[model samples]
Target: MLRKIAGIIFVAGEEGVTLNELAALLNLSPTEIKPMIEEVQQTLKDHPLSPIDLVQFGERFLYVTQADLDPLIKNFAQSPLQQKLSRPAIETLAIVAYRQPITRMTIDEIRGVSSQAMLQKLVSRDLIKEVGKLEAPGRPILYGVTDYFLNYFALSSLEDLPPIEDLALNSQTASEELFSLKRWEINLFDQEE
Candidate 1:
């Protein structure tokens, strides 16, 4: 019972909570807590308001907002109001969305100003996050749009962005390009069509 309550609090109070933190709060080793939570997960497997589930990231465990919870689990789903972005944050977001996993240096080069401060703000808001580090000197961190960003933008996927090729092509040219690419890949002598 206490584990369940502590788990709920750990998830509700922050964007994410590591397993070490959860163990400390529950007065158990992470090893013990792991299986306990798995059991708890099973109990709530059929629950309606219990849409919240544990997210495992490497060795860490955190409670993340699950979009599936929605109107059914209103109380848990009702996130504290999100912070609004300044104009600069919005612009940076656009660049990352279109060219994701982009390094901070590249973002600054494109925007003409260092974006450290704005990037921090966006990270805090959970709209953008460190996807991974670039395999370059100093292993600079790469930023990318989050699932939350896609949800906010109402996009099915990044590919849904208006194709740049479409913008540059007239109808005839666009049709010709598609036909050429299709024929170029198709094998004329293949047994199957």
Candidate 2:
């Protein structure tokens, strides 16, 4: 039962699993779930070879890789180049960070290009994730920065991000200028051809 509970929490990922939710899923009461979680935690603690640990956040429990294994994991998980975010990924991240709980359609509109691959990369990196779904139309998934994002950037909260007005003004002005220049160059090239 403990192993099954741990497996459910592991598969839950960043979303986490609440005590009540787990109890309902496992066909047990919340009282029964608590001891199972403790048993799981004790089992993992006793087994130093286990790579994962169970943690509670609010009313939820999550399985996270043991912090002691960071160095070993980093050594094997990423190459030097892969450690850095690509330009498009950074841009997508910035957009999500500023305009959180936003949908892919909104991100594409802001970027003026498809950001599907970048979004997937960010999700895989645990930088951003699906926070919820929009109510309109097909109910597109809404993306938001993760707790890992805050920790990685050393931000206390989303409010710690630089004021969005300044960023928006600068970004909009620069993109408009770049777009006009690109359009002019394309027209000139077409005329020459």
Candidate 3:
């Protein structure tokens, strides 16, 4: 039961599993799963391999870096960030972020190549999402940067985005805006909405 609970917790990652959900997956009642998880929590107390503890945030739970690991985390954060996307993916993301609610054809026209794969990857990363279908023939999906994208970039709102006129005027290549969703971003996305 402890192993099962731990597996569920790990796979859930920042998106935590509810007690009811865990119980259903384990084929046990919530009452049963609750106490079993309590036992597992106790076992993790003062654990040496991983000092991090499980945290219950209302209906959700997650394991975060222990305070002792702060310096390591800080160093990791200080290092230059890496790109999760290819050049094409970065280009695709910028177009979507700036010209949001834009159709895929528009992105393709700007890039001069089929962007189907890049669009798929952006959607998979939750950086971009299909806001709705466009009014055009075939009603192609309209894409926009997700709340996850906005938070990842540390922008408070869409209004924080630079004007579209600036982007069009600059003709700057679009590599400047690629960012992976950070752990905190994932956590925020996971909370009940």
Among these predicted structures, which one has the highest lDDT?
A: 2
Q: On TM-score, who's better, 2 or 3?
A: 2
lDDT of each: 0.66, 0.79, 0.75
Model 2 regions more than 4 Å off: 1-81, 167-193
Q: What lDDT, from 0 to 1, does candidate 2 have?
A: 0.79
Estimate, for each residue in 122-164, the C-alpha lDDT of model 2 and write its tens digit.
8877789999999898989999999977866679999987665
Q: What is the lDDT of residue 129 in candidate 3?
A: 93
User: Mind giving the per-residue lDDT tens digits that candidate 3 earns over 56-171?
Assistant: 88997767778788998888654323224566777788778777889989999988999999898778777899899988789999999988788776899878876666545555
Tens digit per residue, CA lDDT, model 1, 1-193: 5466445547555555566777787788988777776775565555677756666666665665466756656753333223345567666766787779899899999889999987887786667899999888899999998786666556889897656487347456633443333322312123122
For each candidate, what TM-score against the reference?
0.43, 0.46, 0.45
- Give the distance in Å from residue 82's predicted Cα in candidate 1 to where it truly belongs: 5.2
**Ten consecutive residues with minimal summed lDDT in candidate 1?**
183-192
Candidate numbers sorted by lDDT from highest down: 2, 3, 1
How much is 43 displaced in model 2, in angstroms? 50
Report the alpha-carbon TM-score of model 2 versus the true structure.
Answer: 0.46
Candidate 1 clash pair list: none
